[model samples]
Target: MTHTRFPKAVLFDLDGTLVDSAPDFIAVINRMRAERGRDALPLAELRPVVSKGARAMLGAGFPDVAASEREAWVQEFLDLYEAELGLHGTPFDGVEAMLAALEANGTTWGIVTNKPEYLARKLLPLLGWETRCAILVGGDTLPVRKPDPLPLLHAAQAIGVVADDCIYVGDDERDIIAARAAGMPSVVALWGYRLHEDDPFAWQGDVLIHAPAELCETRAWPGTGTQA
Candidate 1:
């Protein structure tokens, strides 16, 4: 259903929706592989799983390793990635413009992501968004993360907005599921990372956008009303 009013807040997933962090992931994972004497996987092969977090990337880069070992490797990967955070990767094209437009229009925006709070916060200064982001709720900020809805709910609360007054944008199925559970409208970010086997349509977001610039268009937002 199309909303007739502009949402009070817009929430986004950090890794894929707002930032193209695959380069950092690729760099660190490749470095880890090199340490293991394994050849580095191509960027194309690793980009899709970047949003799935370190564990997924580790499994893809080291498929031969036992699942039990992956748990330990996840911490190693996160440690390495934290040290190299913001060394590569930037906001997706048009993301800054979109955010600027939102602020100019008096619409508040925040980030809710599965990335650890400290890591996600570290990116703010690099992008010059340290003072601009309305709120930030990370995976570890609460007992549950995306697909659980609590993060989304807490983000809206943190920003002093109701769930129905917020719209969530994300690249993964779990994002949409969480938005739905939180009673917030959602937009699927088609420009973000996703496996070739993934079907965005199945996520059933209120809207789908192929590029960050599209977010500037009122039609790309969930509500049907003109920009507030």
Candidate 2:
């Protein structure tokens, strides 16, 4: 693995990367289905699509709902999800310890997600991260979101860190792509959600970690230039 000086900041993708938000997605979708006299979907069925966002979750939840109309349901899905957000969501196993490690190492961290800014802000307090998180760049925070690379670059700049000094971590292909475009290093969170056929190795992240606990290892952070 390539090594460099420790990163000044570590920017994360919110939903699947930092938090296990699949439960909340299940709650919102089941609630919506129940209201419409439909059956609830299982977490296993919907979990993989949570990172894909509202439309994807809804598509799985309401398969009967046409793809064309799923876009329209996005607002309602997000609204209901806003209420159910942190109630069912928690940091993925080891996330707390990982954050603590970052703090102990004097490295700053923030979030850049496709979730809307208002919704992301609401989640901070619910997750008890309102004060601890250094910065947030939501999908609506900028003109474009991930895969565009601007949001990742913007988040680094917002926190007064250069792109090379920030590391982006997420579970999606777009996350690695954006980091590459921004000239930033990236870590693929293999513990996060993905479809049955999804191949993370192909994402080509600078590092691929199986669990948040793996991040606690010194080797996971390339900047230290030492194997754990």
Candidate 3:
């Protein structure tokens, strides 16, 4: 995974890696629980599952619900989340500056997340990333999603960059798995949501960065002589 030059493109995971959407999830789920006369869970209790997506969050919020019932509640949760998408969420610290740095260096950057396309697109405009992002590949954009190389490969193709010429940054193991399968180098964003049981080292990302600011330094990137 050595590289003679910096990556031509940088692809990011949305929820946890680029945007700190945990606040939004916390607000929505708590509000939903309140409406059902259920006690609100602590924000800390739910934050870790944010990267795991809606189902996990719902399960945490409604622990007694049946699996089939929880599945039904997912759409309800998504509906609530969409109505207030960017109201409570903001990009992770320094994400905008990192993207700007990449742009100034002539490196195209985009998003490849497990979020649905509609919601992903909706959130971008709210964050003023509509024009800044070179491409976006949502979970449902293809038949497969993260942990599968197709979405990552498709994003590279859409941006006219070879898979090997891209670097994928995400907070989850699935993100690393997908990048590895795509033959692209990857960085694990340690600042993102994760449970106590989660282990970034076990994920084996090419680099582990504690914040988006680290991305501005080429030496901190994978294939740049940084430790994996």
Candidate 4:
């Protein structure tokens, strides 16, 4: 699974890699809790697991609820969130500039996320990325998803790139695991959300980007080796 440096395509994890979606997530979780006569969680408490998906947020907001109640609450949170998708989310700092730079250099890029297809599809339009992203592989797009390597492999195939010619950027351990399994290079997005005790340096991705702006510096990307 080894290869030369500099990938042809860069795949991103949506929630935390490309965008900081914590505000909207916090709002939705809090709103859902309020509806159930519970106190809303503060931002500090909710931001850590924003990239972990709805279940994590639901569990954080309703830790004492019965499992059945938590399931229903999670569904309600999703429904409410769908209506407010992208309301407070935005591409991370320098993300837009970095994407534009990639486009100018003819470097293909796309999204591979554990977010559900419907939600991911809905958010793209709001962010005006409906036609800009080269490809998108949602959690449910295939029989398997991230941490399985199948979805990441699918994204590369769909974009006409070999798995080894793709670099994945993500904020979670699953992202690195998937990239390694798929034979792709990977970067750990340091600006993304994580628990207080989480360690990005130990995640062991090929690169670590502290700010989205750093990504714009393609020639000097932290651990990209030399560009191809």
Candidate 5:
């Protein structure tokens, strides 16, 4: 096996990449829609924008509403969801094991998610991961977020790893963009929540992981004697 140059650290996105928070998010979206006398969207429809933030989900679920109205709806959605956060969310299968593998290998791992820190922190304990993660950089942790690279850079700094020595794994384009901008290698998580219109293979990350467990296998990491 060809040995790929393994990174010293791996930063992951929380919502879709590490945890299956879509169900929890959908529940909140539907609740908000119901309160507004509007019909709730099916899980499939809302799943598409799970990574796009509350604003995108609000706009998609309330397409007939004006932009200003949507903004208010978004705020309401966040507020409501925050109250019931993590009720239906859980880490993806093999997530704990994967994290363990990283720890065993002496590689640092952290979370750099677009989710607000309070909400993200709230979920960590339920998954029994509150203290395991080396660094937790949330949407509110810094002034900027994914697709901007600042969060990724900050996470790398917090984890004591350099951009080139770290890999960022996420289920969205923003994750790849952030990794690229931060000069880190990235993997597209195919196992996470994805829209029907999206294509992980074409997202152009360093690698495309098929499942959560696959990540723990060093063979999947390029240059680790794994195929490119």
Candidate 6:
């Protein structure tokens, strides 16, 4: 049961894991609020739910909007976010070094996110990931998304890696759920968004990392150099 120091590949969750896109989300939400004369929400208040997607974000930004009307609100949020995408977001600290190390070692990597395919694709060049990212599977790329495992499995195959040989890094509980179901090892990104209610330990990830920098040192990886 030995493992390679570096997995065959690493699959990341875009919003919270690889990139700190919360600022972009906040900009969009705040702009929407300002249009209605509402004050801006502190970044801290909205950061925790960024990975939960548009509806959750709109829920916080427009509390007065009825649940039934959320469908329309969500679209508006997305439209604004799409326009704001790549304008404010940047890779999380240490992510560049980690990805550099992976590429230096010839370990392939990709993104699997719940963001719409068009948006994710549109975000690639802006984030300088258009050619760097080996593969991408958006929320709508497949019939189902994370918490379903299909996206993770498909991403692995697309990059020529088997599920068990890949590592999935994400900020949400559903990320671990999908990785586990797909037979890939999961790393819980502690630096990613998590409300006070989130208990990453309870998620039972294979590894829990405090920052993207932790992955920069190849020897520091769990099971690194352990493979026979």
| Among all candidates shown, the one with the greatest lDDT | 3
List TM-score per model, in order.
0.95, 0.94, 0.95, 0.92, 0.92, 0.94
Candidate 5 backbone collisions, by pair: 2-225, 3-223, 3-224, 3-225, 4-223, 4-224, 4-225, 5-223
Clashes of each: 0, 0, 0, 0, 8, 1
TM-score of model 4 (CA atoms): 0.92
Q: Which regions in candidate 2 have their CA more than 4 angstroms from the true location?
A: 1-6, 224-228
Distance from true location, Cα of 200 in model 4, Å: 1.7
Off by over 4 Å in 5: 4-6, 223-228
lDDT of each: 0.88, 0.86, 0.88, 0.83, 0.82, 0.87
Least lDDT summed over 10 consecutive residues: which range in candidate 5? 219-228
Candidate 6: worst 10 consecutive residues by lDDT?
Answer: 219-228
Query: Which residue pairs clash within candidate 6?
Result: 5-224
TM-score, candidate 3, is 0.95
**Model 5: residue 107 alpha-carbon error in angstroms:** 1.5
lDDT of 4 at 134: 90
lDDT of candidate 2?
Answer: 0.86
Per residue, candidate 2 scores C-alpha lDDT tens digits across 112-225 of 999999999999988788998999999999999988999998888888888887889999888889998998888999989898888999988888898898776656774521
Instruction: State the lDDT of candidate 1 residue by residue for 85-130, as single tens digits.
Output: 8988999999988998788778889999999999999889988999
Clash-forming residue pairs, model 1: none
Report the lDDT of model 1 for residue 47.
91
Which candidate do you rate higher for TM-score, 5 or 6? 6
